[model samples]
Target: MAFGIAGTVAGSADAAEPRLMAALGNTVLTMTDIGPKHTQVSVNDKPVFEDKESDMLSFVGAYSLKDRWIALFQADTGAKDCPTRFRILEVGGPQPLVSYPFGSCSDAAQVTIDNDVLTISMPQPGGGGEAAWTYRNGKIGRTK
Candidate 1:
């Protein structure tokens, strides 16, 4: 269905407040920046997961017909060797079912999961080039 966290959940401005939240069908993913390096992700108004990260410069997410979620973000920190990190989190579970790391993260902005194949286009830490992965046999494996 509709993706992206541009829309603020209405009737919630007076509530605790949400920095950004995206909806896919009946499931909702809410993110609140706890600090410069910490973020909390919640579903159905209940906080479920918390992650430590560098300053997030960009974030995007998408959902599949099975209600599985894929969240991608670029984490830029104050380091030369490890300046950024591309973090991916799979949602709709008690915890992340699948996780992947790319480069210091992706300098580009494209992440998609069609069916069970996940194609990610991002540079590696030392120039490894774009990579691909697929979710089959209940595991995530690099394809390219």
Candidate 2:
């Protein structure tokens, strides 16, 4: 799910018509005056990760870097012997700026923003069937 904010300024007696400013989808979910029309959805069957048997699911999580970039997370599931893994997509240019993979099983993940960076934590198998993940630079770097 996503959130946005929209509002217009009132005209002053000494000035012309006021302009509109909005900060959308940063904190909480807000409705926008903009209407949705002619929206399109597309699907790709080709795999981007290494797994061939696993299926991928992508979704938008949060926005950061002054809304110039959005955090996109993709999870690859259904591997024959490996656990599920996830990847992050950076939305600024045409394609994702970074992609990271981790081990865990989850239907979806959440993103938390601090300053201009995003933090994502995942679960992994430990020595005795436990799970832990220490995410770094959009990927899981350590397991505990």
Candidate 3:
């Protein structure tokens, strides 16, 4: 996937609508207005993923796979114990490839990607260690 112009997604063309979060090729990711102060992830003008009862969407990160783009997002409810959802989505796909009920919203800061491995440092109640997943050749799986 190529970003091509790159700036158009974050440029003035999308200034009139919801803020475009990221883009690669024709697949555009945006945080769209859902209701009063609520937003969700929209891909190619379609609402693809939204946290249940979540009021805010936080972009964790995005990675460029060999053939596609994978992104991580958090839907936060602003509660201390509420499990912040860690959503992984393939750009332009129908839905999230995986959604893990991770730790608190603050844990979203621990998510990262290296090469093709996506890792999350889990706090207590999340198995108390690091969980990893791998994306390669258009496939996703738990990294062994």
Candidate 4:
């Protein structure tokens, strides 16, 4: 009996370099790297999230003023029903501070720093549409 080696699926390999961002305290850090396996994430040189099962396209836009918050947008380039999601990660913490789901795609995101607050903006489905999010005291809230 002969066995066949499964070839790499389209868009499965990492095609971009890892972008590093400084986090709060200067000890914690965040990065987004595209590799042969898939898109990978790291915190302070430690591996965090790895998706090798499928082709993942991700973009990291901006960080909070204090560097405690990070905004990441990700999508499956190969999945038909792949939905774009915004993840707010807290450096050196378990899980993300918030995960917001959106139907529209986001090529970029921005974070606004206010007094003791962080605001995130994501593009909406229609043109010139956007969704705003606020993070404060470890809580996530939506603004119109």
Once fitted onto the true fold, the runs of candidate 4 whose alpha carbons sit more than 4 angstroms away are: 1-24, 28-37, 52-59, 66-84, 92-104
Question: Tens digit of lDDT per residue, candidate 4, span 57-105?
Answer: 4555545545355555555545444445455556534544544443345
lDDT of 2 by residue, 28-94 (tens): 2111222221111111211122323345444445465654454444545655555455655444344
The list of candidate 1 runs beyond 4 A from truth reads 1-16, 65-67, 92-100, 112-114, 125-128, 135-138
Error of 2 at 104 (Å): 4.4
Q: Clash number for model 2?
A: 0
Q: What is the TM-score of each predicted model, taking all chains together?
A: 0.65, 0.43, 0.61, 0.53
Model 4 — which ten-residue stretch has the worst lDDT? 1-10
Ranking by TM-score: 1, 3, 4, 2
Full-model lDDT for every candidate: 0.59, 0.40, 0.59, 0.56
Model 4 pairs in collision:
14-35
Better of 3 and 4 by lDDT: 3
Candidate 2 to truth, TM: 0.43
Candidate 3 least-lDDT 10 residues: 1-10
